[model samples]
Target: MSTSAKDIGRLFSPLQIGSIVDCVEPLSAGSEAGWALELLAERPELEVVPIERDGAVLGVVSRHVLEGIVESAWKRFWQKDLDAYVVPARRSVEATDYVDRIVAVDLADVEKDDPGWYIVNHRRAYLGIVNLRTMLEHLNHLRSLDLRRAGEMQKHLLSKKPDEDPRFRICFYNRMAHEIGGDFYRSTQIGEDRWLVACFDVAGKNISGALATSALGAIFACFKLFAYAGEAQLTTGLLNALVHEVNPGDVFVAAALFYLDMKAMTVEIHNCGFSPVLAFIPQENRKIACKMARPNLPPLGIEDRMVNDAPQLIPITPGLRLTAYSDGLTDMTDPFGERYGEERTIEYLRTLHKSSQADIPGLVGTEVDKWIGESHLADDITLVDLRFL
Candidate 1:
């Protein structure tokens, strides 16, 4: 509903215990107390994990634990090889752990005075004290307005299209490392004889990715408007021209441009880094048919090597379905750390064809989740299926 610090805290607080977070800086559990002080000053929010050598708060340090290590100061610790330090964890506490009192004692009575704080187990392992104020501020910062807007944009991006039976079915999904990501897709009929279907992924995460994707979407919409004018159809030249108009960098889209000619039963395709364009003909017993397409050109803005490449030709016979997809579908990793690679993807397509169903997008999503054993898809997944009946 609302993006707020409390929402984030509630989501993350429960998982805080045993959560192994990397140290933002490095600290040491040694005589160099300045290192600990510096780390504490820089990141007061994070609790330091203190190391205990002979059962004392040997001193305090963090995991990155060495942010205070200047290049000049490295020779001191580098010589000893005692650079590694882990925090002394908490064990148990006594009645005086949370108690504070002003005791009247002689200066000499300090010999037996144990001004110890909270103890872990029965011994002293230092779990750095938490800074409540800093923690709260960090939590509140996450509830800012920009994050909320980005979340809303992602919702709009992922919104389902209205059910309709057109010439093709196009569906898209993006994992978006943050509130925004780079993946985008579009389908448009350029003219009576040509159609354009495209999918692309920008290079970064969050706002940069969203901006790049938005730019591509704008380009797609403008091209679609031209196509809708019925003045000139989208061709390789037109596609290249639109790309040339956009400002380079922050955007890299791996897309495939398809030009379908129904009368001639032919399809012309410009494959730009998108892979596994599986063509299945029902008359061929739904067997997976590979089109002899040209090698993928380099992605946008990286190199100018793709200025001219031969378009691959494929015969779009009757009762055939043409499918092209992005790398996300194949780059998925299962729970066992195994990738659902291109080979497995093609096999899945053949199985779907074997079932002979009018609706395949929904089925494709199901099969992918089943293979991965979870619905938590980490990449931007897109699939475009065109059935020429």
Candidate 2:
């Protein structure tokens, strides 16, 4: 059976241009046009034939031009030397060049009417010819496959549902700027009355960001195996150290970790270069009060040791609602280039708390949609809302 297009793409995806180079015996100098015509007639597949002199490529002549010359009653042209009909190669590229890079840059200028063949050489020696059109089609197929797999991996990272609790309700909202992004969140119930809710934003985007989040997920899973107690500081320190160890110096994670204890009526928050955590407290006067918990430490993976000594503790009331989000929400810009500033985010939360809306995350997304209009998001967005019932 013949190899399919998908198989060809997969087989040659990681190779260089030399891997796909076509080796056709070239015509030597002083050859007549009739010899090239006869060769084309025999193969019936070659679109262009190369002419070589002293082991160096002179240029190529298309079958269409040769056929036109013969049909136009130019009998003397066939007897003439082929050198006069050869079109000098416009450009030549090294065979060692990566197939992907060639498709991305070199083939960008190739047109349908232009000759789709490229002269490939290695160490200043002509190796063979490469069909730009075929290479582009194969690489495009490979890219599509890779993007689909990355999207699936991202979906798997966010597949788990938040832990269920009668005493509290949790909701999450996330949207990636691309098919894969850096924003992620996790919820784990360690005790009957204690729950850990965390959100992270990796400094990288696309595959790099997705890979970092995957590492975080593995670390979190290992942390869950230990017995549960009030060790938020130690856990945060361990996470910081591991993140720093796994990623490069420039890559870091902005995160917010919330440890909720229904029994103690308190929530411990650790903010590391993340957006402020909003706390809405219900007052006795039948009104709502809002408070902000700003970041107290640098982002994770930036230092060998955790900077913040301890987390900020907030008293949790029956009607208290805790909201945490990534900076993408506040930093998002409109089509006219105006940011949806932090002040607007705070004011919107205050108004949202006063209302009886149950779907807080959904409402926030709708409001953001209105603010951005048709403009695409520049970063990933994630928002988590927790309410003490």
Candidate 3:
């Protein structure tokens, strides 16, 4: 079978500066400047030629420098040794170094008059040369490839849909504003009749957010393997402490946790800095009543300890539906600079509450699509729906 895109992304090798190193032949320091000028004229691709002495690369001579001397009517200077015109290769790097590490090096320290090139070396032995511009372009290409790989991995994690159950129906929709995002969700069966569903959003966008979400996924996986009695409040507290320990000071997680106990016929909702959980109850005369269970605590990773707050409890009656989403859905903006605010979102959900044939997540996506028109999403969007059978 042919490998898929995700497999191809995972198969990519780590990029290194050695991959771009150019093994151009070096010129002897005793070579005449006229000979170097002739060599440069014959080969237009040679931007800079390295000067060597005693099997060691000393410096480089550019074509421009040679032409400048010739244009100034210095015919006698052309026969002199290239030692005086050699420009020292101050920026040198090991060939084995990762391409990403180049960002940490101070490019501003290099003299503007010197040609932008780096001498590639291995164990203090000169290997080849790498042009500064070519290195930067290679770095960009590597970053793009790495981002696409990350996006694929994140997408794979989110693609796992909850198993079909006889007790309830669960459906969700997720769309990243960029190649990767901070929004994520998970569903796990903790017991024969107990199930846990969670939605989370990490602060920031792209790489920063993606990094935090990756940590969140790892924590969740570990929590699933070993949890104490599968208690919602305890799990939330543990998640908070662990998230705080793993993430940096600037990063935090907004989450909504729903614990479903089929035997007890109830749901316990723990909302921490996330959007309110919307509960819909079918009323008389085909009317629908909606209740909002707002967040009771601050976001995770903001503090080492979770506050003493009780999660909201609701009876799991038939025809009752629960919805949870990330703030990205409400923060979506139109071309006219108007937000698809909470009020509009709630109002739109009300219309879907009475329609039994409606694909809830699909309808929500359609409405947001219409509202935003051609404008891009301001952040990652995620919506999850749980309905009692």
Candidate 4:
């Protein structure tokens, strides 16, 4: 739940303003008016053309203005000076100006108060004028295409729910944002009463995060395969080691791994910079807090040395319900600019505990939806709920 402004910024990156350069043509002021007509004839797509000199954009001439002036008295008023038509490069749009840089604002989120121009780079000595109307139209087209791809990605990545078990009631939900994201979970039954429940959030978004999560999934298969292959090693150290071997970079994942043994009535958990595993067991007069005892475990695949604490042990009693969720839930923000954080999550669990319900995960999601006021999830959401019968 320790999210940052950078986190939300990554999900909706904008298109570069320099991408519109193809619509402009640079020319020198010495060029004859006939050359402008030739340029227009050769490329009729451009609305306005800039005339440059010594690597600096000095002025521009638009076809609309050029057509109007040429057919009017200006042709006679400046019959001797044809170069008088060139005008200074525009520095204001709707009377507002902005510095040049890679624009990181999402096109859909732009406001009427925003500046009409953005310079994407300084590689060129001088910046040119921009047709704000045409640029925004292009952005709208790209946004439609991107949303379509995101929809397909969501359908392809959401796996079918595993079969129901008589020993435990399981409810799982995964919701992708408008763009593909890096949140996933897995549930594996190793034996009659042995299961592994894992959920992780890769510190990435969109295509990069999706690829990283897919690689991590392959590593997870190796772990599950080895466990059934009789060389079983269910340690966070092993997970950390495998990631270190495959991924030696700045990126890492927040994960919580749980091993449930019904026969022994115990749950062993490894919390690697992941949110504490939350569980509530109804006792005669009080609610037991089975949240991970150590909450400061470091995330996996970061430190060269082992940072995750050893797996902690917890005794399980009858009527125990637990929930595992990604940081997306806690990062949910409201219209009032408040995050639906851990404190509210704990309070929800307390309420669910009192009700003794089986749909803890589903209700938690509903609570978040009500708080955020929409189904358009800004971040990926994943949740898992289990109740020991």
User: Which one is best on TM-score?
Assistant: 3
Which digits, one per residue and each the tens of the lDDT, describe model 1 over residues 27-140?
A: 333435454545456545544544444444443345344454433376445633123544332232321232111111112333342222222221232323322233233344
What TM-score does each of the candidates earn?
Answer: 0.56, 0.77, 0.79, 0.62
Q: Could you tell me the C-alpha RMSD of candidate 2 in Å?
A: 5.2
Query: On residues 1-389, what C-alpha lDDT tens digit does candidate 2 reach at each position?
Result: 11222243433334577667665667876766666788777667678788887777878878887777677665644445666677777568776688777777766677767756778776787766767776777687777788789889878878877776888888878988888889999988767778889999999998899889999888767656775454678778888999999999999999999988778888999999999999888888988777889999889999999956756998887898998889889889899989998999888877777555467767888988998999989999898888888
**Candidate 4, 1-389: lDDT as tens digits:** 01221233432233544344333446676665555666777667656566666655555666766666556775635543333555653342221222122222334445564424322223433333554554666577776787678656545645746535677766677777645678867776666677777787777777666766767667656656766421113455666666666664777888877777778888777677776678776667765665533344577778655653455776767787777777787787787768889888667656766543446556766787798885345677777777777
lDDT of each: 0.52, 0.80, 0.79, 0.61
List residue ranges in candidate 4 displaced over 4 A.
1-61, 74-151, 175-178, 191-193, 206-208, 221-235, 285-292, 304-310, 354-362, 373-380
Put down candidate 3 lDDT per residue, 54-161, tens digits, no spaces: 787877888877777676766545545665777877678887787666745745565665446778886687767776667678778878998999999998888876
Q: Which segments of candidate 3 are over 4 A away from where they belong?
A: 1-16, 28-46, 52-58, 63-87, 91-103, 111-115, 223-228, 307-309, 354-362, 373-375
Q: At residue 247, what lDDT does model 2 achieve?
A: 99
Worst-scoring 10-residue span by lDDT in model 3: 1-10
Q: What's the true lDDT of residue 351 in model 2?
A: 76
In candidate 2, position 65 carries an lDDT of 73
Q: Work out candidate 4's RMSD over C-alphas.
A: 10.7
Task: Identify the runs in model 2 with alpha carbons over 4 angstroms from their true place.
Answer: 1-59, 67-71, 75-129, 132-141, 225-230, 354-358
Model 3 residue 55 lDDT score? 82
Output the number of the lDDT-best candidate.
Answer: 2
Q: By TM-score, how accurate is candidate 1?
A: 0.56
